[model samples]
Structures are given as structure tokens and as C-alpha cells.
Target: MIGNMEIFLIILAALILFGPDRLPKIARELGRAIREFRNSLEEDLAG
Candidate 1:
């Protein structure tokens, strides 16, 4: 299980790697990928 410190470290690392300029774009793409994955799972379950 990850704690708050772990989450913070991950975010810090991401900031260092991607920088502030591209973080929002990366986050938006990640969110869309997750949303699409969930939608596909729901469709599979319902069908």
C-alpha cells in the first residue's frame, strides 16, 4: 500500500521528468485512457 509520502514522491519525480509545461497534457491523456478503459470494461460486462 502506498502512503502519502510515496504519492508525493511520485508526483515530484513526474514534475522533474515532465516539467510543469507538459504535466497537464500528460494528465489529460492519462485520464482519457483510464476513462476509455472503464467504458470498455462496462460494455463487456453488460454484453
Candidate 2:
């Protein structure tokens, strides 16, 4: 499992790489992708 410091470093790297303006947009897309992936997994398990 990742520690808080590790997570913070990852976020810091992402901010530097993607910049502040695009980070939120990227996060939103990532969230949507995760949600869709979870939904598909649930449907598959239910079916």
C-alpha cells in the first residue's frame, strides 16, 4: 500500500507534468472512467 508521502509525491509530479489548468479536467475524466469500470464490473458480477 502507498503511504501519504508517496501519494503526495505522485500528486506533485502530476501537477508539474500536467500543470494546474489541465489537472482538474484529467481528474474528472479519470473519475468517470473509474466509475464506468466499476459499473461494468458490477453488471458482470450480477449477470
Candidate 3:
């Protein structure tokens, strides 16, 4: 399980690597992709 310190370090690394301004947009797109992927998997399983 990831602890608070690990989460903070990951966020800090992302901020440094991607720049703070682009992080939110990146996160949003990542979330949408994950959601769509999960939905497709669920549909496949259901069918």
C-alpha cells in the first residue's frame, strides 16, 4: 500500500517531470482513459 510520503514523492516527481500546470490535465486524461478501459472490461465480462 502506498503511504502518504510515497504519494507525495510521486506527485512531486510528476510535477518536476511534467510541470505543475500540465499535471491536472494529464491526470484528467489518465482518469478518463482508466474509466473507459474499466467500462470496456466490464462490458466484455458481462457479455
- Top-TM-score candidate index: 2
Sort all candidates by TM-score, best to worst.
2, 1, 3
- In model 2, the worst 10-residue window by lDDT is 7-16
lDDT tens digits by residue: candidate 1, 1-47: 99999999999999999999999999999999999999999999999
lDDT of each: 0.98, 0.99, 0.99
TM-score of each: 0.89, 0.93, 0.88
- Tell me which residue pairs clash in candidate 2: none
| TM-score of model 3 (CA atoms) | 0.88
Q: Which of the two candidates, 1 or 2, achieves a greater lDDT against the reference?
A: 2
Considering TM-score, which of the candidate structures 1 and 2 is the better prediction for this target?
2
Candidate 3: stretches off by over 4 Å: none
How displaced is residue 38 in candidate 2, in Å? 0.3
